[model samples]
Target: MAYTDDEILAGLAEIINEETGLETDAVQLDKTFTDDLDIDSLSMMTIAVTAEEKFGVKIPDEEVKNLVTVNDAVTYIKNAQS
Candidate 1:
């Protein structure tokens, strides 16, 4: 079954929160992963890997650059699943 956007967002939230040690409530769609969440390049890659596994989608290295916010990741996974 395909996952809903909310489910994808929640999954990304968990990954971001775990990787960055940030509160889940602080993770919002509009928030910038780097500026708002303080996610470094290395940590970003880690989140990407975890997201790929959790969402069952492959996030290419080049595409990783485009995922700058929580919304971006959630959208990508939702679309990829479809």
Candidate 2:
């Protein structure tokens, strides 16, 4: 069930949009979830949980912090799938 980066990005963007009401196009590779997107910790946690379920990957609590940017999360999930 591996996904290309574009597919992952689109799916992640959709998740972010659903959780935060953000436009899917606003989610870019370099956008920081907190600084750029203004995502609070609670939203981040929710996004992490949702992403885990959607991507079928276990994103540990501690590792969530390391996922600072959209690209960071995309890369982590891509690697986790492998």
lDDT of 2: 0.93
lDDT per residue, candidate 2, 1-82, as tens digits?
A: 9988999999999999998899999999999999999999889999999988888999999999899999999999999996
> TM-score: which candidate is best?
2
Weakest lDDT window of 10 consecutive positions for candidate 1:
5-14
User: How high is the lDDT of residue 7 in model 2?
Assistant: 91
Error of 2 at 41 (Å): 0.9
lDDT of each: 0.87, 0.93
**TM-score, cand. 1 vs. native:** 0.93
Off by over 4 Å in 2: none
- Alpha-carbon deviation at 11 in model 1, angstroms: 0.8
Worst 10-residue stretch by lDDT in candidate 2?
48-57
